[model samples]
Target: MPTLLDIEAEARGCVRCPLSEGRTQVVFGVGNPNADLMFVGEAPGQQEDLKGEPFVGRAGKLLDQLVMEEMGLTRDSFYVGNVLKCRPPGNRDPKPEEIESCRPYLEKQIELIDPNVIVTLGNFATKLLLNTTQGITKVRGQTYPYGKATLVPTFHPSAALQGGGGDVISKMRADLVRAKKVLATC
Candidate 1:
């Protein structure tokens, strides 16, 4: 099987989607390749696109804090990735075509890491993984079986920082704890 590095290297040259055309570089997934836990976000934002890493912005800082507190682990202990490897211009929601084009890459990441639990950090990741149109508000804090792993949904850290306040943060914390519990069983 191709390794994660091999997948990432190939993904860097991908032109399957228009988002790739304007991107500085592919923000391929990062963190432990064999991690028991994985975080999947919607898409790379400006900071992630520029830095070629997922969750390295202000929202990422918040996620880092919560992951440490709730899971007793650092971000490096788990895998982090996005639905779309390339940034959508202006940070808009990824269009359906964009998502379709990038699905294979995300699937490859999941196949490679084989994480025991996947914590989706927003509507896009949650909806895609769950194969449902339900919003994160409706699905956050619940767990569902996905392939060989359990999937948990949570608000994006950006939501917490974007006036979602204590409630969203608390929910995200609860979801992280749930992910930790799922990993223990795995």
Candidate 2:
């Protein structure tokens, strides 16, 4: 099996789609290589693109806060990454072709990290990982089998930042708590 470093090396120079053209760098996943849990978000934003790390912005901070509060865990304890390693122009949603191009990297990540539980944030990450077209609002609050890991779906932290109100934050917190529960059993 290929290591994360092996996949990242190839991904760093990937030009499989137009996304490669505009990205500042491949915002590869970060955290413990052998974590019990993993978080998969939609894609890198401008800050993440510049930093070459996933979830370093306000959304990330909020995620960190909630995970710390609810799960008693930190980034050092879990793995986190995105569906699209490269950023789309203007922070726009990823196109179908872009998702297809990036899917292998994420799959390889899932294989290498081998986290016991995976919590997919928001629509894109959830749908892609679960291989379902259902929206996050409908699919979240549930868990499913994903390779060797159990998958948990949740609202992205960006939703809370983008005027989703306390209800969204509450839901996200609940999901983190749920992920923690799964980790315990795993």
Q: What are the per-model C-alpha RMSD values against the true structure?
A: 0.8, 0.6
The best candidate in terms of TM-score: 2
Model 1 C-alpha lDDT per residue in residues 21-138, reported as the tens digit of each score: 8999899988999999999999999999989999999988999999999989997799999999999999899999999988898999999999989999999999999999989989
**Per-prediction TM-score:** 0.98, 0.98
lDDT of 2 by residue, 1-186 (tens): 789999999999999998888889999899999998999999999999999999999999999999999999999999999999999998899898899999999999999999999999999999999999999999988789998899999999999999997999999989888888988997
Output the worst ten-in-a-row residue range by lDDT, candidate 1: 177-186
- Each model's lDDT comes to 0.92, 0.94
Which portions of model 2 miss their true places by more than 4 Å? none
**Reference-based TM-score, model 2:** 0.98
For model 2 the local lDDT of residue 177 reads 88
lDDT, model 1, position 147: 97
